[model samples]
Target: MSRIVVIGGTGYAGSHIAREAVSRGHEVTVISRQAPDAPLDGAQYVQGSVLDLDALGDVFDGADAVVSALSPRGDMENEVIGALRGLIKRLAGTPSRLGVVGGAGGSLVAPGGPRLFDQGFPEEYKHEAQVGIDSLELLQQTDDLEWFFIHPAEVFGPWVEGERTGRYRDGGDVLVRDADGNSTISGADFAIAVVDEIEQPKHRNDRFAVGY
Candidate 1:
């Protein structure tokens, strides 16, 4: 079993990914500022902030892979990008592969077209979307850091509460949509895609999307 560390593992997406990893028999550790409301089974939870490089380094040590499922919110909005940079710095020369949970805002609606953020994305979510975009851009510029950014569809979140079908469509920078022109996926299925990528290592040093 591979040793896996999931930053912000108690949050919605992070928690689901942690559970999926544990179910797969991988040794999983979750690091976050706050603990989950209900503890996850078969996964170890470490309460701490990602900003603490010393603590973050300790948890990341000797891990096979690290999944960053952190979202940009509140105080985290301005800090997520910096935290990611710090993570990359710490992971330099390490064997761990970094996996990031990205937002659709940075994804493309069409090939060679404007990013979703420039295509009339909601104003309230603009900041978070840009943060995701910036994070992807930063990763793209990093040299020799094994990484993959997983972007979800436009309609994905805890509020959506999509059903877990154990299935999803994978796409490149373009957004994936159903025949009816809808884009969505449950948190559970998204986690499935993530864990699959973690185990198989497809789309290395690139970005991809998953949706129903």
Candidate 2:
């Protein structure tokens, strides 16, 4: 049972990951701005924002792994990358591996081709996509820290509510799609992929995608 800390454990992706980790018998701690209306069983919920360096450091200390599922919104619109930098600094020389929930915007639409964001993605989501892109670029520049970024398919979220098949596919930067040329995965199954990676430590210091 490894000690795991999820930075935005109450959010859509974060909450699912937290639940999956708890179900796996890991010591799970979720740090969020506000408590969840209904919390997960056998998980500790800590009320705090990711922007709080001191609080984040406290929660990150002594953990086997840290999953950063933070998303950009409102006041945090431009602060995601900065917060990640701070988190990386805090984890310096620690044994904890950082796992980031990345966006498809930074992923390649085709093998060795242009990124999804470069292909003129929807303007409404451009801001968030760019943040993810920047986060990946920043991670690439860092050295000596163990980190892994997991990018889900183009169609994945709470709205999608995909069913968990307990089976999914993993890939590199190239986006994974089905035979019909569709890319999607359920939140539950995506959580499964993440927890599997956390336990097995595949794709270390690298990025990968999950889809079905």
Candidate 3:
């Protein structure tokens, strides 16, 4: 089983992913500003801040893969991409694979042009949402790094907990939409997709979007 490190594992999306990874028998370690309210069965929770470079590296030690589910929020919140800059540097020369969670707005809607956020996305989400977009850009420019970026469709969060039918559509660059022209997915299904990538690596050094 892989020893996976999940940053921001206490967040809504991160928690779901941590749960799925543990259910699959992987040794999962969750690093968050605070431990999850109820830790997953097979996972270890570490209460820490991602902005602490040395402490973050300790979490990555001996890790087979690293998944970043970090998002910026509130007044004192650390900048998502900024914090990752240090973490990525610390992971250099390691055999670990990296996967980062991105937002729908960050997913490309066109080639070398507009992102999903540019297409009339709400201003309220621009701050935290743009962090994901910038993080994806940062990952793309770092050609030397081994990383995978996963973007969830328009529908994401605790409310959309659908069953794990083990089926979903994958898209490159653009967001995937359903018949109703709405691209969305339950967080549970999103977690399934994340763990699936852990077990079977795909879209390395590239970004992928998933939806119903």
Candidate 4:
């Protein structure tokens, strides 16, 4: 089993990824400021923030792969980017692969087109979502790490835990929509997609989207 470290592993997306990874028999380490209530079986928990590079650096030791599920809110004047920059630098010249859980705001609706955040997204979440978009932008510019950013569809969160059909439509630089002309997926399905990306390295140095 591969040793996987998930930064921000206590959040909505991170916790799901941790659970899915453990179910796959992979050794998982979760790094976050707080631990989850019902932690996944067969997984290690480390308390730390992604903004703290030094503290976060220790968790990466001997790790085969790392996943960033860090979502920074507020003014975007934080160290989320700084922490990722450090991760890229530390992973440089190493064999560690990176998988990022990006927000839907960064996912495009068309080829080489504007992101959903740029279009008619929610007003309340516009700022934070844009920050997420910017974070993906930073990840895109990082040539140091072998990484792929996975963006989920519009309807993803704790409310919906999709059934494990292991069936999902993947697309690059374009949104995947259902027959009703809506782009969406459950959090569980998105978790499956994230783990699939970890097992099969696709869309390296680029972003991809998933939907039901």
Candidate 5:
């Protein structure tokens, strides 16, 4: 089994990812400043902050992949980018892959055209969306790093936590939407996509979108 570590494993997205990886029999380690309300049975949880990656000690050692499910909100609104920069540096020459879970704000509404963010995104979410956009740009500039960024559907969040259908589609840099213009995916299915990529990666040094 691959050893996987999630930086914000106590959060909504990170927790789902940790659960999925562990269910798949992967050795999973979760690191977060806060403890999970209900920890997964098969996952290892560690208290740590992504802002201080250096102080995390050997938490990432021998990991097959490290996913940053951290969000730029609350006290962390201004810290995600800086922490990501440090993370990239640490995994720069290593064999472990770095995967970032970003918002759909950066995804193109249409190929070679306007981004979802530029199309008048909600004011309240603008800041967090901008951080995701910036994170994508940061990864793109890292030529020597083995990294991949994933943008979830526009309606993804804990409030809309749907069931796992064991199905999802990759939009490859473009936002995914159905016929009625609904763009969404269940948290569990999204986690499935994440772990599937971890096991057999396809979007190396690239960004992709996942949706129903």
Candidate 6:
């Protein structure tokens, strides 16, 4: 079984990922500043902050894959880039693959043109979106790191939390939309794609988009 480590695992997206990984028989470790309110059956929850470089840097040594699901909000607003840069340094040259769960703001609404963040994205979320955009740029330039980033559908978050259907589509480098032009994916189903990538190793050194 793969040894998967998920940073920010107690959070909405991270917890779903950790749950899926555990269900797949992988040895899963969840890292967050606080323990989960209700931990998963087969996952191990570790209390720690991603900002704790010295401590967090040591958690991924033997992991098969490390997924980062950190959100750029609250006290972490405008600070996720630093944590990600730290992870890039710490994970470079390691056997583990690094996976980043990015926001849809960085995804192209239509390929080869303006990004979603540039297309009149909500100002309230601009700061968080900027971090995601910057993080994708940072990952693209890291030639030494075995990294893959996943941008979830546009209408994602707890407010619209959907159910798992064990299904999703991957739109590489662009946003995935339905016939109605709606881009959305259930968190559980999105987690399936994340864990599937971890187990199967597709999209190496690149990013992929996920949606229904």
Q: Against the hidden reference, what TM-scores do the models get?
A: 0.97, 0.97, 0.93, 0.91, 0.98, 0.97
Candidate 2 per-residue lDDT, tens place, 69-158, comes to 999987888889999998888886889999999888888888896998888799998999988888888888878689999999999998
Tally clashing residue pairs in candidate 5.
0
Clashes of each: 0, 0, 0, 0, 0, 0
Scored by CA lDDT, what does every candidate get?
Answer: 0.90, 0.89, 0.83, 0.80, 0.92, 0.90
lDDT of 6 by residue, 26-79 (tens): 999899998677989998877888788687556787999999999988888867
Clash pairs (backbone) in predicted model 2: none
* Most TM-score-accurate candidate: 5
- Cα displacement (Å) at residue 177, model 4: 1.1
Runs in model 4 deviating more than 4 A are: 74-77
Residue 22's lDDT within candidate 4 is 94
lDDT of the structure predicted as candidate 3: 0.83
Best by lDDT: 5
Residues 1-212 of candidate 4 have per-residue lDDT tens digits of 88899988888888888888999999999987876788888999988776666765567877888998877654324656777777788787677888877777878778888878878899987765766677778777877678888888787777766666777899886778888978778766788888888888777788789987
lDDT of 3 by residue, 1-212 (tens): 99999988988889888888998899999998875677788889888887786765467888888899987777424478778887788777788888999888888775675788888989988887888878888887775568999989887877776666767788877788887888778778888999888888888888889998
Across 57-170, the per-residue lDDT of candidate 5 in tens digits comes to 999889989999999988999999999999999888888999999999999998885899999899999999999999989998996679989999999999999999999999
Candidate 4 CA-lDDT value: 0.80
